[model samples]
Target: MKESVNSYVFHHCVTIPTIRKGGPRNNTKTYSTVDDAENHLSPQHFCLPHTLFNRSFLVAVILLELGFGSIPMATSLDTSSTYSGILSSSSPCFVRPSGSGTVYYYQAIQVTVFAWGMHTFSSSSLMDTFSCLYNETFFPDRSSQNLIESDDDSNGAHQFRIRLNLQPGRAYILVVTTFSEIVTGSFQITATGPMQPVLSSAQPITTTASYVLSSSSPEFARPYAYDYNNVPYQAILVTVSMTGMYTFKSSSSIDTSGYLYNEPFNSSDSYRNLIISDDDSGGNLQFQINASLQSSHSYVLVVTPYRKAVTGRFLIEAAGPERLELTTYRHSAGPYSCGNKLTCKAGGLLKIIKSMVISVGCVGLLIGVFCCRPCTNKRKRTLRQQLSLLRQNPISQANSIPLRNVSINTGRTNEIDRPYTISISTVAATYAEQPPPTYEAAVLSSQR
Candidate 1:
């Protein structure tokens, strides 16, 4: 048996019409096989749409296939395996016998160029520059029969579209290339979902006051304090309304109530009408007196509360009385005094004089009784007589010698005598006679 060596040939050609500014345009068609051209062409050079041209190209391919008789080729192709270039390359082509009963298989190669034009073009015209070559193979192989595609331009993007009749259950590699250096980029596609809503609750509010006034224009000096919870608070807008004998007064003077008149009291002012607002937390508000007020001037100051979305409560309390205006008097040294003067006038001086006089009179009376009573006493006569004698003869000469001698003797005699010697027996006169007492008694007895 003689062994036959199989030879293969394949051809690929592409022609691009040069675009001119103003040129005659012609419609042209291309075919790959003689049979394809003959069956499809209309005597003109044009072939059927998408049909291959050039009969010689098909003949050369067949002759090469016959040269390699009895050789087997890959039935499937992988384009990436054969494609290679700095910027461009070709892809591997796979062949099996045409849908006929023949078992012969063929292999081919295809060249592709990716070019980017600054201007946009139709997709059909963009893929026309590609070419392919087919050859017969003699051996069965398991390696890939695929190729990578390439482009010729490097300055900008070059895009092309390709058509393939891919097998449903088989995997294949597709290749793209460029003439210029590959400028890599990325692309992505995505999708999204739906949206939603939110709901919330608001805060409860409260308020209180420090002072409330009683004048129609009474100063509602105390501020209102407000509180809130759960919701955000913004500002407190205060409005003061009055009932009874009062009205809201907005003035800058003493006669009227300057309630929320010139807004925004500053730090330097001594008083203010303020409505303070804070966040969900609580804060203090202040109002202050502008002028004094009188009693019985009844008034009511109302406080209102507000916030961003939250509300607040308010209360009113009265500031105390105005200062007392008292009249002063200068005291005179007289009766009808009220203070220290009255105390001095009442009984202080009289009590002092009466006490002095009583003390002096009592002392004088005591002295008079001591002197006169002694003189009046008969038993004290001797002492009075002696005192009188001494007073009469306070100084005496030789004539006084007698008095001195007398006094000396008297003093000596009085001293020498015993107290019992001066008896009543000598001092009393003779008793009445009881002469016959004894005799009478005797006679009576004899008679009896």
Candidate 2:
């Protein structure tokens, strides 16, 4: 029995039937051992032996599979001395000081120079007091730009490294020697700037929305083919939603340009797959790209500066329709489709115009009926008065009619001429009855 228990643990085998608390029970379905333990454990209850194990054993195994004992590292970056050659210095070059200062040599290429890593250097043990001097003047004289020194290369080992950006064809001298005396000895120094960092080394971006990029961040993409402001650039992956036009733009304080690539940039050679590159043509020095994109395609966007070394905060924007539209597409019956936006507004406007015209016509009709009713009553009253006057003095009523204004140009006979009266406006007559307020009004009235 003990041997069977040991075999069961080693082979991960289990025997069912005849397992009892005090001893073996013979009445149950008898089996010497079970072929599959999982089959016996979950669906059907097994009379497991308490002598060999407890109830928590299966759960404990599950916990171990869940990595209970395995823990992830708490931190990623390593600041220990073990990172010796990881961000290593350039190859140490031998230099000797003959005359003024110890001179080391280096050259820069292209229109701009991007310092890669921190400049680094080391001095010989023979010199107790020494400093590293760097300047652009080829041969130093009184007028040559006074030396910039790096006597301690951040590690404080009496080593030296001073970073300098030298233009093409401009000669620079990096001298390593004592303050006053010209020392003649070999010194190991890295005659180069820092090594350029890369895309993977940049901050990882995973979001789909707009984000801000600063020169202060650990990101910038500069293809080797680019001679201008490799400035700083950040990598972003965007998913194209539809097969249509999409715009990527930047609104930045500094002049900026945006470059789109079909793939993540690894080498300068990847620029051959560039979709489009826009400079100030977008807005300011900012970039804008409008491209016909395929649905479900992923694009890599690189945001950079236009002028070399100029970097600031910039905003990225994407525009144009990528979703389904009802009005634009004939098949779409969506509530607010392209057709709905315009047609809905137009229908509302038509309804409003129609209602306004009907309301105005109805009001004018009502007003006309109301005004005509009073005029009709007055006409009947006048007719009744005329009839009564006809019964009394019809001749006097006809003679009582008011006369109209007669033009002075009428050719009437002077012999039978009656008293002619011409009525003027009450305002003008009021003014004529009085005196004019001023000389202008008096003149206008008198001329009239």
Cα lDDT over the full model 2: 0.44
Q: In order, what lDDT does every prediction score?
A: 0.28, 0.44
Q: Residue 355: error of model 2 in Å?
A: 80
* Model 2: residue 353 alpha-carbon error in angstroms: 72
Give candidate 2's TM-score: 0.24
Model 1 misplaced regions, further than 4 Å: 1-329, 334-345, 348-380, 383-404, 407-448
